[model samples]
Target: MGMGMGLGLGSNMQQNNSKEWVKDASDAQKGVNEILSFEEYVALAEKRPCLECRPSCKYIKDIFEYFGKSPRGDYNLFIKESANSTAVYGQQRVYEHIYQNILNFTEEGFNNKFILLVGPNGSAKTSIVRKLMEGAEEYSKCDNGALYSFSWIFPIESYIKGTLGFERRGEQKESCSSQTYAYLEDREISSILSSELRDHPLLLIPASKRQQMIDTWLKAFPSELETVRKSYLYYGDISKRNRMIYDALLQSYQGNLAEVLKHIRVERFAISKRYSVGAVTIEPQLHVDLRIQQITMDRRLATLPPSLQSLNLFSVQGENAMANRGILEFSDLLKRPLDAFKYLIMTMESRTINLQGILTELDIFFIGSSNEIHLSAFKQHPDYYSFRGRINFIKVPYLLNAEEEVKIYNDQIASLKSKMNFEPHALECLCLWAVMTRLRPALAKNYKDKKLGELVTTLNPLEKALLYSNEFLPARLDSEEKKLLKVSIQDVIREFENENLYEGKFGISPREIKQIIYEISSKGLMVTFVDILDFLNKFIDRKNEHDFLNIAPQGDYANPVRFIELLKDYQLEIFDHELRDSLNLVDDRSYEGYLIRYVQNITSLIKGEKIKSQITGRYEDIDHFFVKEFENNIKLKESPEIFRSHMMTTLGAYSLDHPNKKIVYTEVFTDLVKTLKESFREEQKKVIVNIAKNLVFYLSEVEDPEHKRSSSLSEEGRKEIEIVLEKLQGKYRYSQAGALTLARYLIKEKY
Candidate 1:
C-alpha cells in the first residue's frame, strides 16, 4: 500500500503532538544511585512522599480510595476519555475553536453549542484538528513531553512551610541497638534518658503535647515499655538543653506526616489537568461507552438515527436532550443525502444519553458528511426542518490543474527513464490524456460534508498511473470517439501488414499514440499549424499483434524433419544484437546506427530446451571460456577493422565513429595490405578479391568449428604456428573469417 494507501488514506500519516505523552519513559533504573549520612538519609527520604503509597495515590490512600479511577482503589489517576486535544491549523486558530467548543460543555464562558470547519477539502481542516493534538512538538518548547505525576513534585519543601501541619514528638528508642527503633525496656529507657532528663528536665515534656504524653505513656511506660513500646525513636529532650531538642524533633515529625498527605493529593492534580496540545486521548473504555449507545448498523447506511417521527427524544422535553454527548462521527458522510440533515444537527447540539438507568449527560461533538444526496428531502416535506447550522462543509476539489498535471507526469517520466528508456513526449502524452479525462471520477469520490476533531489526506500520488495502465485504458472506454479512432488506425495497420510494414514509412499501432504525440510536439512533421483530427482512429489498433509469422514451422530448420522442405533453400536472419552484427540494411536508430535485428524472423514454440539453453544452463562455466577466447582471438588476431566493426554492433553502437572503434583500429592494424584488402566491399570489387585475405585471417584464429571461436595462440605457440601460417598464406595476406554477410545470414538458424 505504499505507506499511507491501504487504510483509506496514505500511510505517511503525520505524527500527532501528544505522542510524547505515551512514549516510553527513559530507563531510570539503570542510572545513578546515591547514599547519605544518617541524618541526611532521613531528610532525603522525607522528600519523596510518593514512596509512601503507589500509582493510584502518592501519599494519603484514604483520599485516593474516595476519588481515584483505578480498579486497585489506591491510584487516583483518571484513565478515562475526554475530547481535550488542542489542534492549531497552521496558526489559523482552528483547533482553538474546537477546544473552545468542547470546553463550553463544562466551561460556561463561551457556551458554543456547535463548532464547525467550513472549507475546501485538502485545505487542512482535519490536519488542523490533528495538529492541535499531535502537532509539531518543537514549538511546544517542552522537551520531555506532557508529564503527569500523581505524586508531589517537592514534598520536603511543602512540609517545612507549615503548609502541612503536625505537632509533638513521640517516645524514643532506649536500647543501645544499631537500628533506629530499638526496644524501649524500662532498664534501657532509664539508661538512655538519664543523661537528658537530669540535664534538661523541661525537655521531658513539651508544653503543648505534654499533658497527653503524661496520660498516655508515663503511667504505663515504666511497666509495659518492653512489650508495647519495644520499638520507638526519641527525638526530644536528650540533654541538659535537650528540652529544646525534644520540642523541635516532635514538631518536625508532625510536619513530615502532614507533608506526606499533601504530596499524595498534589500528585493527583487531575482535578486541574489541562491540555498543552490539541489532542486529548480517551481510552478504549470510552470508545466502548459510545458504541453501547449507538443502534445496530445495516449495510446501506449503518441504519438511521433512531428518531424521525419520534423526534421529541432530542429536545429539552426528552430525557436525553441533544445538549450532552461525547461525539458525532461523520462516517461515510458523503454517502448520505444533503436534505437528510436533521439527525446530524441534533448530534451537534449538546446532548445526553440514557443508558442502563443512568441519565448520562455527555457533551456530544458531531461530524456529518455526504456527497450530493438527499437535497430534495428538505423541500419534499414542509415539516422537514432537521438541518440547521450544524453541518460544516469541506469540499474535495477536482484533480490537478494543467500545470500540476504536467509536473506529475514529468516526475513519473523522469523516474522511469533512468531505469527503462522512453522518449520524453511518449510518456508525457499518455499521462496528460489521463489527467484531462480519466482521473475525474477518483477526485469526485472523496467529497463529503462534515467536520472532525482532525482530518487527513489519504490519496496517493501514483494511483493515476497504475489505474490508467492496468484498468481504465484497456477496459473502461467504449466511447464513439475511441471506436472511430480504432477503426481508422486498424485499416492503416492492415495495409502495412500486407506489405510487411514498408521500409521508409512508419508502422502504425496503438502504441503510436504516444510516439505520434511526441513527433507532433517535437515538430517532426512540422505540423505546428495543423490539428490532429480523430487521433485515435489515425493510429493502429492497440489490441492486435502483427500476424505474419503466426504460421511458421517451429524448430531448428537444420533438422530436416523440423524444416518444411519447400522452404529449405530460403535464407533467414537474427535480431538480438548480442547474437548478430549492427549494420542493419536500414539505418533506423538514435542517429548512432541500426540493428541487423532478427532476419527471417525465426519465430518458434519450444516445449523443450536446446543448445542456447544448454550453454545458458552452464553459462557460468561456458562464460569463463567464452571471455578468454574472445579476448585472445576476437579482440587480438582479427584485423583492427573487423574487431572494431563486430564489437561495435554487439554493444548496440550504430556508428563506426564510436571512439572505442577508433582505439581498436589504432592499436591492431598490422599491415596496410591486409587492412586495405578487408575494406574492399562488394561495391568496390564485384569479384570479391582477396576474399581469401579475410577468410584466412578469420579461419587462422578459429580454434572451434561448431562455433567460430576466437583463440589467440599463446606467445610460445604463436611463434611456432606463425612460421607455418605465414608460409602457407604469404606475408600481408589472408582474409577475416565468419563473413559478416554469412554470419548474419546463418545465425537466423539458431534463434
Candidate 2:
C-alpha cells in the first residue's frame, strides 16, 4: 500500500512538471514571434511613435530615472535596477554636465560633436562610459527600449521564380500571400542578407512616403512628433547594400513598393557590448575603424536573382559599422597618432565615415577618453583648433570628498571582512589621508566675503576634506562663521572648477588605496587604524615613485607626510571618544540632551520669558547659574550675553531654514559639541589614562598566560577592563584581537 501511495505522488509531480514545461515553451514561442512584419511594425509605430524613432540621447535618458537634484546642484541620474546596477559615485558634476548635453542633443537635434571625457589616470573616465553602455544594453532587452532593424530575405530559387514572379511568366502564381517571408524556415530560404549598419527598418520606405506616414501616425503625439522628426529615422536612408537590393526588387516588381517590401524582414534587435551588436569599444591600435568588402563572390549568394547578382554588392564591415544606432567609445583616444584618427574631424561633423570614397552614414553617439597628459599634448598640436569645435569636454576628477572616498574602500572592506577583522575607522583613516593630499589651500582674497574668505584661507587639508564631505565644521569657527562657511561650501568646491589645475586632479587615487587595503588584509590578522597609517607612511617614503607625494606643500595642503600626522591626531581624538564611551562616562545622546536643555534655558533668558522645566513642572526664571556653568564647561570665548545672542541667532536661522523639522541640537551646534567633548576629555583625563593602562595590562596578560597569574589588577579593575573589551567588540564591530591592538596603541601613543 505504501509503494502504491509513493507512485501516485510521483506521477502527480511528473504531471505538474510537464504542465510547467509546456507553459515555459509557450512563453518562449511568444518571444520568438515578437519579430514583426513591416506592416505590423508600422502599426506598432502608430501606437508608440516616440519610442519607434527615439534618438540615442533620449534612449539613454529613458534608461536612467531622474532622482531629483542634489544639494550641490548636480542632477542625480538614479541607478535603477534595470540599468545593470553599475554605480558611479562622487562624480556629480560630470554626470550633470553629461545630462545637460543629453538634453541639448534631444532638444536641439543632433549636436554633431563627440563627448570627450578627460581626466587624470585612475579616475573613472572609462567606468562612466561603460556604465552608460551597459545601461543601454540592458534597456534594449525591454519592450519599451526595443530596437528594430531590417534584413533582405531571398526565398529558394523555385519559390522566387514561381511565387515572387522573378521569372516574369505570362501569369504570376502566389503560393504565399503573406506580406513578408520573415517567418520562413531556414531550410526554405536561400539567403538572409543582414546589414552590418543595422539600418532602421522604416528606411525601406521611400523618404517622402515614410515622412507622410510617420506624420499621420505621430499627429496623436504632437509633442513627440518634433523630436521624432529630428531623429535619424526622418533623415537617414538605407545602407548602400540595402539600397541596392531595394532598388533591384523595385525594378523587378515594376515599381510595386509593396512587392519590394514583401522581401524585407523587420526584426527586433538588442544592443550588446558582448556581441558588438551596437555598443563597441575601440582600443588604441593603428588600424582603420571602417572598411568594406564585396560580397558577390560568396557561394551563399550564388542562387541570387540575376538583377542583384549583376551588381557589385559591397558589405560595410568594421567597428564604426558595428556601433551603428548606439554608442562607440575610443579608449585613450589621444594615445593614437594624430594622423590615425584625423578622419574624426570631418566624421564627427558630417555623421558619416568615408570608406574608400564611399560614405557610410552613421547614427552613433561617439565617446572618447584621454588622460590629462595625453590631452595636454594633444592641445599643443596645431590641429587642436580644427577638432576643438567638434568635441565637448567633460572632466572626470578624482573624488575630493572623504566620505565618498570611504565608500570605495568600504566596498573593498566588505569582501575582506570575512577573511579578517577591521577596527573601527581603519578605512576611514586611509580615505581621510588620501583626500587631504588632494585639497588645495584656499586664497583669502579670492572670496567675495572678506571675513568668510579669511576663514577659508585658514582651512587646513583635513578641515577642507571634512567641509567637502559635509561631515564636520571647522572647530575654530564660531556659530555664525561656521554658518557662513557651511553656506559657501558649494562655492568653495567650485572655486577652482574652471581652472586647469583643480583640487581633485592631483589626489592619491582610490586604486592605490585599494591596493594598500588588500596588502594589509593579506596578512590574515586584525586590521587596525594604526596599521593603515603605518602602511601609508612607509608608502609615502618612496617619494620619487609617487608623483603626488613629491608635490610641494601649499600652506597645509599637498604634504602627504604631514597629512599622515594629522590623521594620527584625528585617530587619537576618535580613540579618546571611543574609550570614554566604553567607560560610560558621557554618551553622545546624553550630552546632546544636556546641550539642548542649556540652549533652551539661554533662549528663554535672552527673550526675558519664563521656562517650564520638565523636572520642576513649574514656570520659573531662566536658570542663569546652570547656563553659566554649562558655558564655562565649554570655555565660551565670548561674553555670556554675546554668546547667548549668537546662540539665539543660530536657533532662529535654523528654525527658518528647516521649517516644521525637529531640531537636531548636536548637528546644529557642531562647534559647541566639539568644545564640550574636549572639555569632558580634559576633566576626566586622569581616569581615562588609568583605564587605558588597565586595558593594556589586561590584554598583555591575556596574550602571555604566565603573566596573567602574577598580574596586579584589582577585581574591580579586571571587571572594568573586561566590560570595555566586550563593549568595543559588540558595539564597534571590533574583534578581540583588534580591540587588544587598539588598547596597546592608545596606551603607547594616544594616552
Candidate 3:
C-alpha cells in the first residue's frame, strides 16, 4: 500500500509538470480571431483611437448608424415601422442634437463635459439613457463592436501545459504580421489574472515608455494626426490588482518590460449594465462603496505560488470603479445633496477620481438626469456656476405632438402581456389630454414685438400640436395665411424653446396616463374614450397636490376641463363628417373624380391644350364653365384666367424643382377639397337625418327595459341601417361605439 501511494504521487507530479496542451478550439478562436494582440490593437488605435478613448459615444453613434439617421427636418426615420421594433417617435431633434454633439466631441476633442438630460418626471429622460445603454451593451458583444482587456498569464506549471524548459522569459520571436504579437504558442497561458477596471491593454506599459512609443508611432503616420491633443493615450492607469500583478511579473523578470509582456494575454469582453461589465447606473444614495475585498481562503487561492502570494493582490469595487472604460449614469442626479457629487467638477475636467487616496483614472462617459423642479432649484444654487462648463444640459420635454404622444400609449399597450380590448381613441383621448396639460399658451408677450405675433395669437394648443407634428395646417386659413404659417413654423418652435415656461415643461406625464389605463383595464371595464376622459377629469380635481395642474394657459385652452370640452367639440366635428360618409347615401368617390377632372380642365385651359371629355367621349376645348364653377368655390381674388395661369406657374416651378415627384393638385388646393366636402355634406343632410332617426330608434328600442312588446324594424329599414353600419366599420374602421357616437352627433347636428 505504501509503494502504491508513492507511485501515485509521482505520476500526479509528472502529469502536472509535463502535460501537453491540446488547444481548445473555442478558446483558440476566441483568442486568435475575436481578440486582437497588443500590436494589432495599437495599429487600430493609430487609425481610430476614438474607439478606446470615447467608447461610449463611439458605440452610441455606431448604434445610431446601425439603425440609420435622418437630417434635421426629416422625421420619417424616427417614426418608421420595423418588423421587430417599435419606432422611436417624437425625439428626432433630440437625437440630432445628441448625435451631433458626440461627433463634435470625438472629432474636435470636446471631451471635457458630461451630458446631462434635464426634464420633468416621465419625459423619457431615463428612457433615452436606458435605450442607449441597451444598444451599447448589445453592440459590444458583436465582433465589429469588440472591446478588449488584458490579464496577467502567469507561468505556473500546475495550471499550464507547455513551457517546461523556458528559462528566459523575454526570448521574443517574429510575429506572423507586424500588427500582431510575437509568436509564443509553445508557452501556453496558465493563471489568468483579471481586472475589475477593464483598463486599456496599452496601460500595461510603463507611463514614460508608453508616451514615447505613442509619440514615435504618431510620427510615423503624420497624415493621421490632428490638431487636437492626444491626451486620451494616457487616460487611465491599470487597476491596483493588475498593477500589483504587473509589478510582481516585472520583478520576477528582473525589470525587463518585454519579458513582463510575455506573461500577458489579450482578451475580448462584452459590456453589461446589470453586471457592471462596461456600464453602470448609480442612484443618489451612498451606494458607491469601494473597499478592499480579500481573496477567498479556499484551496485554489491559498495554493498560489509564494511569488504571487507575497503580492497580496486584492480586488475593489464601486459604482464608478465598475463603470470604468464605459458609461456611468447618475440617475435623478440632483435628488441628492449637491456636496455628495461635488467631485464631479474635478472628475469631468480631469477624467479621474480619488479612490481612498489612490488617484484612479477613467475613460468613461458620465450621464446624469434631473427633474425640472430639482434643476430649477439647482440653478438658484451658488455652486451652479462652478459646475457649469463641465455639464451640457439637454432638455427632455413631453411630446408636443398628440400623434406622437399616442404612439407612447400604443407601444405601452402592445407591450402589456394582457388581452384586454381598448376602445378606439381611448389612448388618443388620454394622450391628447396629457399633451394639453403640458402645452403653454403661445405667449403673446414673447412674440408680440415680432412679426409672428398675429399667427401665434391665433394658434391654440391643438393647432400648435398639428404644426409641431407637421401633419396638417388649419383648414380654415387662406392661402396667404397658410403660406405664412408654414414659413414661420421654425421661428415659432424656437420661440417655444426660449419661453420662460416651455410648451412641454408642465403636464400630467405619460406615466400618469399609463397608470390610468392600467387602472381602467384592471377594473375589467370597457377601456373607452369616455372612461379615459373621466379619469382625466378626476385627475384635474386633484390639482391641489399636482402643481402642473395649476399651470393655466392664457388662451381658450386655459384649463384642462376647457381643453377636454374643446376636444369633444373637435371630435363632434369629426363625427359629423364620418357620419355623412357612414350613411352611404352619397358617393365621395364621384366627387373626388369630379375634383380631379376640374383640375385637369384648369391645367389644359391655362396651357391652351385640348382635353378628352369623359361625358361626351370626345376631344374638346377645356371646359371653361366647369373650371369657373370650381374657381368660384375657391373665392380667388384674381380673375379666373389669372388664377388659372398662377396655378399653372406654381405647378411648373414645383415640377422643375422636384423632377422625380408628381405635383399633387389636391394638396395645393386643400381649401377646394374642404369646400367640396362641405357641399357634399349639405347634399347628404336629409339622408343623414333619416339614418340618425333610425339609429336613435334602434338604440332606444334595444335599451328600454319597460317596453313589453318586441322592438322590431321593417326589412327595408334594417337593410338600410345594416348597410351603413358595414360601411362605417369596413371603410372608416369605426367600432360599434364609434358608429353610435357618430349617429348621435348626426342626429344633434341635422335632425
Candidate 4:
C-alpha cells in the first residue's frame, strides 16, 4: 500500500512539473528577440510616460531615486542595497557635488565637461564609477529606462527589387503589404548595418523636422517637452557613419521620408559593461581610445544597394564611440601620459571627438578618477589651467565616520563571517581606530566663539569619534555645550577641508584593514577584538612602510599608538556593559520605566498635586522619598526645586519640537541616563565580578579536560554562568572561545 501511494505521488509530481516547464518555455519565448519598428518605438514611448528623451547626464541622474535625507541631512541615493555589499557610505557630499554638476550640465543643454573624482588612494573612486555603470546597465533593462537605436536593413536583392521600384522597367510587379522591413527574417535580408556608436533612432529624422514632430507628440505632456528640448534629441546630431547612411537613404528615396523610415529598424538595446556597449572604462594607456575603420569593402557589405555602396562609408569602433550615448569612465586618467588624453580638452568642450578626419558628435557623461598625488603633480604642469577649466574636480574622501566605516568592513568580510567565528565589537574596534587616524584635532583658534572652541579643543580622539558617529556626546560637556557641538558637527568636519592636507587624505584605508582582517582569520582561531588590536599594534610598529603613519603626531590625530589606547579603553567600556547585561538580574527597560515614574512623581510634587500611579491606577500624593532616592542615585548636583524646573523646561522644549510623539526620556536626557547607567554598574559590580570569575573558571575547565571542575561555584552560580555564556554566544555573536577570551580579559583588566 505504501509503494502504491508513493507511485501515485510521483505521477502527480511529474504532471505538475510538466505544466511548469511548459509555462516557463512559453514565458521565455515571449521575452526573447523583441524588435520594434520606428512606429512601434514611438508608440511604446508614448505609452510609457517616463520614457522621455534625455541627455546622458539627466538620464544617469534619473536612474538613482532620492531615498530622502540621512540623519546627517545628506541626500541618500539608496545605492547600498545591503550590509553585505560594498557601496558608497558616508560620501553623500561627493554625490551631492556630482548631482549638482549633472544638474548644471543638463540645464546648459548638454554635458560638455569631464567630472574628475579626485581623492587619495583606495578611496572608492573606482568603486563609485563602477556602481554608476552597474546602475546604468540595470536601468536599461527597465521599461522606464528603455533605450532605442536603429540599424540599416537592406532587403535581399530579389525582395527589394520587387518593392522599392528598383527593379528593371520590364520586370514583373509584386505587391508588398508590410509598411516596415523591421521584422524581416534573416533569409529575406542581404545585410544589416548597425552603428557601434548606438545612435538614437530619432537622429534619422532631419534635424530641422525632428524637434517639431517631437514637440507635437509631447504637446499633451507639456512637462515632458521641456525635458525633450534639453536632451540630445533636440541638440545632438548623428554619428559620422550614421549620417552617411541616413543621407544616402534619403537621396535614394527622393525625399520620401516615410519610404526612408520603412527600412529603419528601431530595436531596444541594453547597456552592458561586459560588451562595452554604453559603459566603457578606459584604462591608463598610451594608445588612443577613439578610432575609425573603413567598412565599405568588407564582404558583409557586398550586398548593399548601389546608392550606399557608392559612398565611402566608415565604421567608428572605439571606447569613445561605444560609450557615445551613455557614460565613459577614464580610470586613473592622470596615470596616462599628457598626450594620450590631451584631445579630451577639445572633446569635452565641443561634445565631439575627431576620429581621423570624421567628427562624431557624442552624447556622453564623461567621468574620470585620479589620486590627489597625481592631480597635484598635474597641477604643477604648464597646461593644468587649460585642462582645469574643462574638468570639474569632485573630491571623494575616505569615510571619517566610524559607524559608516564599520559598514564597509562588514560588507567586505561578510563572506568570511560564515567560515570563521567573529567576536562582537571586533570590527567596531578596527573601524574606530581607522577613523580616529583620519581625524584632525579641533583647533581652538579655528573657531570664532572662544567658549565653543575651548569645549571642542578638550575632546580626545575617542570622544571625537563618538561625537562624529552621533553615538554620544562627551560626558564632560554641559547640556548647552553638547547642543553647540551637535550643531557645529558639519563645521568641525570641514575644519581642514580647504587645506591641501585634509583629514581623510591620510589614513589607514578600508583596503588595508581588510588585509589585516584576512591575516587574523588565517590563523584558524576565533577572531576577537584582541586579535585586531594586536595586529594593528604590529602594523604601527612597521610604520615606515606607510607614509601616513610616519607623519608627526598632532594632539590625538596622527598618533596611531594613542588611537590604539583609545580603542582599548572604549572596548573595555563595551565589555563592562556586555558583562553586566549578561547577568540578567534586571531588565534594561525597567530602568527607563523607573526614570519615567520618578519624573512623574517629581513633577506632581513640584505642583503640589496628586499624581496618577501607573502601577495602582489611582491618584496619590507625590512620592517625595522615591524621587529623592532616584535623584541621589543619579548624583544630581542641583537643589530639588532647580532640578525640577530644569526637567520641566527640557520636557517642554522636547514636546514643542516633537508634538504628538512618544517621548524617549533616554534620548532627551542622555547625560542623565549616562549617570544612571554608571550608578547601576557600580551597584552591580560585585555580582558582575562573580559572574565573570565563574565564566572564566568554566571556560578553563572546558578548555582543559584534565582540569577539575571548580567546587567553589554554587549550583545557582553554575546555572547563571551557563546562561551568561549562552547569552554571550547567542545575543552577542561570540563563539565559545571568543567569550572565554573576553571573559579572561575583562577579569584580569576590567574587573
Candidate 5:
C-alpha cells in the first residue's frame, strides 16, 4: 500500500511539472514568432508601424526605454537607470548623458562617431555595455521591438530531375504558396540560403530605384505612415554576397523585378551578442577579416538553377558583417593599434567601409569603452583631434554614495550560489570605507559665498558622502541655504572636477571588494564587520603591490586605519541609539498623550474659558500646575499662554504647507521628541549604566563552559536583566550574541 501511494505521489508531481513546462513554452511562443516571409512581414509592419523619421539611434533608445522606466525628468522614454540588470552602482549622470547623446543622434544621422565610455579600471565600463546589449536582445523579442532580416531561397529543381513522390511525416501537412513550395519527397525541393550579414530583404532593391519604389508605395498609405516610410528610406544597401546573389537571380529572371522578389524570404531576427546575431563585440586581434565566400562545391549548390550554378553563389561573414543593422561594440577600442581602428573614423562618417576594396554600406551604431588612462594617452596622439569628432566620450566613475555602494555588495551577495553568514553592517562598513577612498577634499574656491566657502572647506569625506547620498545637510547652513543645498548638490559634486582629482575618479573598485568577500568566505567562517575591516587593512598594507591602493586620497583620508576607525565610530553611534531606544526609556504614547492634554488646556487658557473635566464631570479652570509639568518636560520655558498659542500657530502653518493632509504633531515638532529622549536618558542614566554593567558581568561569568558559574542573582535581579534582554531581542531583533555585544559596548561607553 505504501509503495502504491509513493508511485501515485511521484506521478502527480511529474504531471504538475509537465503542466508548468507547457505553460511556460506557450507564454514564450506568444511573444514572438521567429519566422516570416517578405509578404507576411510587410503586412505585420503595416499593422504595427513605426512613425518616426529618425536614425537607428532612435530605435536603440526606444529599445532601452522599453525595458526600463524613465528617471526624474518628464521626458518621453528618457531612461536614467542605464544598468538595467547588470547592477552598476551610482552612475545615473553618466547614463543620462549617454541617453541624451543617443537622442541627439536621431537628428544627427550617421556621423561616423561612436559613444566612447571612458573610466578608471574596474569602474564598470564593460558592465554598462553588457547591460545595453542584453536589453537590446530582450527588446528585440518583444512585439513593439520587432526587427526583420531575410535569407535567400534557392530552388532545387535539378536535384531529382522532376522525379518526386509525396509522403506524410507524422501529422505535418504541406502548404504551397507563391513564396514557398510544398515538398514531400524532395524532387521539387529548394535549398534555403543563409547570409552571415543577415541582410534586410528590402536591400535587394537597388539603391537607385529603392527610393522611388518606397515613395510610390508610401503614397498609397494613410498620412500617418509617412514618417516610418521616410525614416526607412535611408536604410543601408545589401551586402556584397547578397548583391552577388541578386545579380545572378536578376540575370536568370531576365531582369524581371517581380520574379526576383518572389525568392526573397524575410525572417524575424533578434539582437544576440552571445550568438553574434546583429550584436557583435570585437577585441583587438591579429587578423581583421570581413570577406565573402563562394559555395560552388556543396551538393546543395550543385542542385541550383543553371544560371546560379555557373555563377558564384556568395555569403558574407565576419564581425562587421554579422553586426550589420544592429550594434558593434569595440571593447577597449583604443587598446588596438591606431592603424587597425583608424578606418572607423571614415567609415562612421560615410556609413561605408572599404573591405578588400569593396565599399560596404553599414547601418550600425558603434560603441566602445576604454580606461581613462588609455583615453588620456590617446587624446595626446596627433590623430586624436581628427578622431575626436567621431567619438562621444562619457565618464563612468566609481560610486560616491556609500548607500548605493552597499547596494552593489548586496546584489553580489544575493547572487552568490552558496549560503554564508554575514554580520550586520558588514557590507555597509565596507561600502563606507570604499566610498571614503573615492572622495576628494572639497575646495573652498568652489563655493560662491564666504559662508558656503567655509562650509565647503570643512566638508570632510564623511559629510561629503552623506551629501552625495542626500542623507542630511550639516547644521552649519541656514534654513534657506539648507533648502537650496539639495538642488545645488549635484553642482557641488562636480565643482572641483578635474582630469586627475575628480571625486569618484579614484578609489578601491568594487571588484577588489568582491574579491575580499570571496577570500573571507573561503575560510568557511562567518564574516563580521571586524573581520572585513581586518582584511581591508591587510589589503591596504600591501599598497605598493597594487596601483590603485598606492594612490591614496589626500590628507587625513590617506591612512586606511584612520578611515576604518571613522566607520567604527559611525557604527557605534547607530548601536548606541538602538540600545537606548530598546530600553523603552522614551515613552512615545505617554508623550503624545501629554502633548494633546497640554494643547487642550492651553486652548482653554488662551480663550479665557473653562473646560469640562472628564475626571470630576465638572467645569474647571485651566490647571496651571498640570500645564507647567508638561511644559517643563519639553523645556518650553515661556509664558504658558504664549507657548500654547505658538503651538497652534505652528500647526496652522504646517497645514497651509501640506494642504489636505492631517497635521502630525511628531512630524511638526521633530525636535520635541529628540529633546524628550535626551531628557529621559539623563533621568535614567544611572539605571541604564548599572543594567549594562550587570549584563556584561552575567554574560562573562556564564560564557565559559569549563568555568561555568552561576550569575548568582536575586529574583528581582534576574527579572530586571531578563526584561532588558527581551526588549533587545524582541523590539530591536538582536540575536543573543548581538545583545551581549551591545551590552559590552554599552558598558565600555557607560551609557
Candidate 6:
C-alpha cells in the first residue's frame, strides 16, 4: 500500500484486472466499470487498438473524432461510435478485413455507398465497428523508424440520429440508431508542410505484410512498447506494467525476468530500428537529439493498387476531405444494389428523410448488411418491404463442416486463454458457451454468430453453462430453485435404485423430490444423470411388477411388458394433472393452473437446489435458456388461435417483463380456452384422456439436448415439443407457418 510513490502512477495505479495484460479477458473486463472520459478512453484504446501490428498515425483517431464530418466536402459520412469493447474488438486477423470491407464501398462510381450492418440484438457487429475507431488513430509504423500516422483528415460528422438519405428527392428513412453526416470540415493547420501531405489518405494494407511496418514504428518510440511489451515486446502501456506484474506474477517462473527486460531499454527513452518490417533492429535515440523528420513513404500496400503515391496526415486541423468527397448518401434500394455498404442497418432504414440541398451526389463505401425487414423488431412497417433486394451479400455462412467448426473453436479458445491470460479451462468454458449458444438458438434467443470473446468478457463459464444447460434439456427450468428440483429428480434415481424410499416403486412425489434435492445440495455436489427416471418409479409401489436384476431396458427404468405397463399406470396416477398441462391436455383445465401445477409438481419433487443447478450447469443463466421450446409442441396439433394463445401465455409466464406474477388465465390464453372447448366436444372422453396422458408422459421426458442444430435438432429444444405433439399427430408438423410461429416462441422463451 505504501508503494504508491514508487510507481509514479500513484498507489491508485495498482494493477487491477483492466490494467493486467497477462490476465485473461474475464479478468481484464472485471475492472471495466471505471469511469473514464470518452477522449481519455479512446486515447488509451488507440495505444493497444490492434494486437496485430503498430497502428498508422497515433493521432489518426483524433482527426476522425474531432473533424470527421465533411462528406468528401460534398456529403456527410457518419462514423459510428461504439460503447462496448466487442463493437471494435475482433481477432487481429479480421481487423484488416473489417477496414477493407468498409473501404471497398468507396470504390469508383459506386452508388449507395453507406453501410448498414444488421443482426439480432447482442450480436457483435457494433463492437467490431467500435474497436475500429478506437484503434484507427495509428497503424503499424513504416519500414523506417518513423511512426505511421493515420486519420481521415476529411472532417466527417454524424448526428447520432440524423439522416441524409436523399435531399433533392426528399427520399430518406428516419435515422434508426443515429443520423451521421460525415463531411470535410476545412481547417488551415497542417502537420505536414507540403500541401499534398497536409491531409490523410485512406489506403489498403494487407495482413501479412503489415507486421513489418509495426516493428519499425514501435522501435522509434519506447513509449508505444509499454502497452504491448508482453505481446510485442516493443511498445504497449499495459505491457510495460505487465512486465513489472510479470516479474511479480512469474517471479518464480522458469524464464528469467531480468533476461526478458534486459534489452527492453527501460532507461533509454527513444530508440530507432535499423530497418522496419523486414529491416534489422536499431539502437536507442536520446530525447531532442533525434529529429522528427517529414519523409515520403514508398511502402508496399497489398489492399491498394500501384497508382497511389505519397499520403499525407494533418495533426492540428480537420481537412476538407468531406468537402471534396461529399456525403456518402443512400436511399432504400429495396432489392437491387445489395452490395452497397449495406451493413448499416442499425440506423436509417424504413423511416423517411428529406435530403434536399443537404446532399448532392454522395459517394462512400457501404459494407452490405442484411436490411430484410423484421416485423418483430419494427412491427411490420408497411413501407419497408419484407424482402428487400438491396445491398450485396458477403457470405459468412454457418460453419457446417465439423472440421471448420473445430478450427473456429480452437481459435476462439486460444485467444481467450493466451491474449486474456484466462485461467486454465477458460477456453473450454468459452467454447462451450459459444457452441451451445450457436447450437441452441432458442437458448441464445436466436442470436446467430457466436462470439466467444464477448461471452467470456460478459459472464463466466459456470453461468454460461447454466444458461445453455436448458438447451441440452427440453424442459423449461427458469428459476434457480426449479433447476435444483430437476437435479433432485436425478438424485431420486439414486434413492430409487439404491435405497428403498418408495413402497419399492418409483412413486416420486413432488414433495419428496423437493426434499431430496434441497437436502443433498446442502451436502455438496448435485445429483444429475439419465438415471433420474429410477427415482420417479420409487414411489410407484412396484411390488409384484418385475424383477430388478433383469435390468436391460432401453429406458432408465424398465420391467417386463406387463410390469412396465403397471409402472406407467402408477406414473399416470401420480402425475395425472402435471402430464395434462404439459402435454396440451385436451381438457377444460385452465392452461395456467395446469402449467403451474405441472411445474410445481416436478419442481416440488426435486429439491430446489438440484433444480437451480440444472437450470444452469456452470453458472446462473440469467438470459441463458434451460428450456426454449416445448410450448410449440402444442401448436403442432392445436389450431392457429390455440397455438398463438399458448405461445403468448407461456411468454407472459416467463418473460422478465412479467416475472412478478402468474399470467396463465390472462387474455393471452383465450384462444387456448376456445380451442379446448372445440376439441373436447369433437373427440370422445377416451381420446381426450389419451391426449392428456400422452402430454404428461412426454413433458416428463423433455430435457435439453446436449448438442446443437447441425443438419438436425437432436440436441435442439424443438424435440421436447415434438415429443408432446407426436402423441397427437404421430409426426412433426412441417408447415412453414407453424415452424415460423414456433420459432418465434422459441426465441422469446430463451432470451
Best by TM-score: 2
Better by lDDT, candidate 5 or 2: 2
Measured over all alpha carbons after superposition, the RMSD of each candidate to the real structure, in angstroms, is 30.2, 4.2, 8.4, 4.8, 5.7, 30.0
Cα deviation of 245, candidate 6, in Å: 60
Model 2 C-alpha lDDT versus the unseen true structure: 0.79
lDDT of 1 by residue, 1-751 (tens): 5544555442233344244434433232112112111222223223432221111111112222233334523122222222443221122123334433443332221122443443322333343433322222221223112112111112122343532222112433232221221222222221111120112111132334433433344343442222212111112222211222233334545644322222111110111113311113222121122222221232212221122112212112221121121123333333334443333343335333333433333323343323223322433645444443444333322222223233333433354443433321233333333232212112222223121101111212122223322221111222222233233332321222223212111112222333555544443321211122124323223334422112232232112122222122211211122111122212213212111111001111111222233235531212334333333432245453443344444334323446455333322222221222223222344322223233334445554556466654455554433443343234212211222223323333332
128-214, model 2: which lDDT tens digit per residue? 888788777767877787888877778886765454433223434344444466655677688888877988887877888888978
Q: Stretches of candidate 4 above 4 Å error?
A: 1-33, 45-52, 66-86, 163-178, 220-223, 584-590, 601-632, 636-646, 684-704, 707-710
Q: Choose 1 or 5, whichever is better by TM-score.
A: 5
- The deviation in Å at residue 409 for candidate 1 is 8.0
Ranked by lDDT, top first: 2, 4, 5, 3, 6, 1
Model 6 misplacement above 4 A:
1-108, 111-113, 134-136, 139-359, 366-382, 385-389, 393-423, 440-751
For candidate 2, the TM-score is: 0.91
TM-score of each: 0.24, 0.91, 0.81, 0.88, 0.81, 0.21
Query: Which ten contiguous residues of candidate 5 have the minimum total lDDT?
Result: 159-168
TM-score of 3: 0.81
